[model samples]
Target: MAKTLEFAYETPQEVKVGDDETTFTLVCKNEGLPVDLTTAKLITVKIGSRDGYLREQPISIDSLSKLPTGQFKFNFDKDTLDNFPTGSYFLEVWVADDQGTSIYPSGNPLNFIVTANIENSSGATITTIAYDDFVKELNKAASTIVKGDKGDKGDKGDKGDKGDKGDTGATGIQGPKGDKGDKGDTGTTGPQGPQGATGPTGPKADKGDKGDTGTVDNAGLISAPAFHSLQTQVNNSAVGTNLITNSNFSSGLDHWKVNPGANSDCKAVVTTDSDGDTCIHITGTGDACGLYFGPVSFNQNQVTTASVLAKGIGTIWWIGLQSRPFSNFGTISTESYSKIGSIMQADSSSDTFCVYFNPVNNVVDIYIKFAKLELGSHATDWCPNSAEILTQSDYAKIKAAIVALGGSLS
Candidate 1:
């Protein structure tokens, strides 16, 4: 009875297992004898396999007690040591005094080792405990969180406090112009548009008013002075004695003559009346005399030589000569003259008479030649009531027989 008790034990030299919670501290030292232990029990504490050391269901150390210099404070719950098991934890502290059940005091046999002070492998709470000291503390915290020797950038931070003017923000209601945005895909075609700057020259207009003169119809009568007086008589001279001495006769008529009776040749007898129209009463003498008429003719010595045979009016005469100089004068009767063999003489003193007037068979084909200076005639009455008189002395004897057959009358 003198030795009331003797027990000794202290734990948690190092025991840590976590994920939720675990800690260890159990010290019970009582060399017994101060004896006021009325009920202290943690009677059994054994956890997993050191050859099957079971019994872990009773954890009631009751916050431990027994102190009066016996040193006992067993607080090992930590939620039951986090349901225990991270290695070597064999603790058995059975203590009881004062009649609940005898006590088995055993403490020094304690080998406290629940070592894992925040380190675990399969239950997971290892924060780089060793892998080469966690790669040298993660390379010294990544060399102070990366970015070394480049220092020059720091002076920009003092500009922020002007904030209270915000009430003017209500005017932003105009945001609706946004729908035109889709045309942007055409961008690669922009290098070709720079050539357009040349337009500024507009003001010089006032000069248009002068057009009105167009009306010409049927303007015809230009004989150009009768073709300039027939080209000045074919340039003065010899268009075959100026066409038989300018032809156009009828002044004292005659120059044709060769009449002996009824068919008297060279007779300048032209007649027309009762509207058949004509005129012929020459007296310009025998064969109609020289200024024109005579191809020659006769009738004189009337009653004594008994030559009284008168039947002389077979009319068909046209003699109009004028270029002068006719010396032969005898046997020149273009008999009855109906063309009298187509006279031609052109030179030995020019003679050309190609006549053919048939005032309805009042026949007159007298073409006599040999005209040197005078061969002009003109009685064109072509019957139908004839009245084409033209006579200013037969137009001055056909203009002096066209200037004596050497043309150029002007």
Candidate 2:
């Protein structure tokens, strides 16, 4: 008996583009007597478009002599559908006798779809119909073409009329001016304005009248006393009496006297005569008697009563022997009186005592007097001719001396 063969077209239902090529199996099963099918040289596979026209080329499964259990597979190159558009195509498998002389009815025809609509690749298509039902639904009358819903229509409107022409009325009189507007708000300050031009010179003013002179004071012009006046209250006291009385050394002597001895030593003696009148008598001669009155205490070896008496007598005779005048007498020295150290006689009588005058005090009145000739030989021309005699030069010297003594001579 002849062998009966069964076949199937096996390809994936869905595949992506550019994947490995698909394999279609043309399965054959041996159901009758064993046949030497190894002699068959070719098994044919026919692919067609969905329109039912056969493809111009057919793929052959070769090497059937090595076919086992009557099964065969053919792997078509993936480039087979490179130029085809994305759509469904068809595959058909058939077989023929090894001699190519007759068709075999032993293998039933098998069908598959060549789907260019890749599963997930770009440009692939998605349809609601199942892949198996695609060809049937594509042929259905009402389902073949799909239409989208239509959009709504727009409304219409009426046309506008032309505007009326304006009237040409007489020109009315000009309206009254409007009320003044409110002041505008201040804006941001601008740059400072330029400096203003200089103003014109003004006319010269009249001279003002002179003012009255103020009253003049004569006190400054008057001389300050050589000695301050003894206060009237102090003068009335016993202290004042003691100061004046102790200053006097002799009652017969009306004023203090200075008599310097030849040895340059001196003595200052006070004498109260029987009449209770007082006097100061000095005896001796030298420079030691130059300073007669001062705050200094006398040492017994340096100062004697005679030297003090000579200086006191010299001062008194020159200035009328006023107590206040002699108060500052210590400033006199041999340098100031060297020209007139000898006692000066006021008269030609040899019995007359020699004396000195305070030339600065106008040389008036007797200031000091020596006793009779027993007193000593007078140092030549040492005395003034009279109590009132004073040269202009002597007055000047005395004035300067008072000033040197810190007394105001003015």
RMSD of each: 82.9, 76.0
lDDT of 1 by residue, 1-410 (tens): 11222212222233455433323433333321233332554355444434555545444444444334433444455555565665443445455544554332231123333445555445666533434654554454444432334434434434333323222222223346878765544323223333444444444444444345433221221222333344444443322222222223332233443233223333445543233423332222222221232232112111000000011122212222122111111111223212111111122332323221111123332223222221111111112101234668877888899989888555
Stretch of 10 with least lDDT, candidate 1: 301-310
What local distance difference test score does each model get?
0.32, 0.34
By lDDT, the best candidate is: 2
Q: In model 2, which range of ten residues has the least summed lDDT?
A: 298-307
lDDT of 1: 0.32
Q: Estimate each model's TM-score.
A: 0.16, 0.23
Candidate 2 error regions (>4 Å)? 1-20, 29-37, 56-62, 65-67, 83-108, 116-410
On the 0 to 100 scale, the lDDT of residue 263 in model 1 is 34
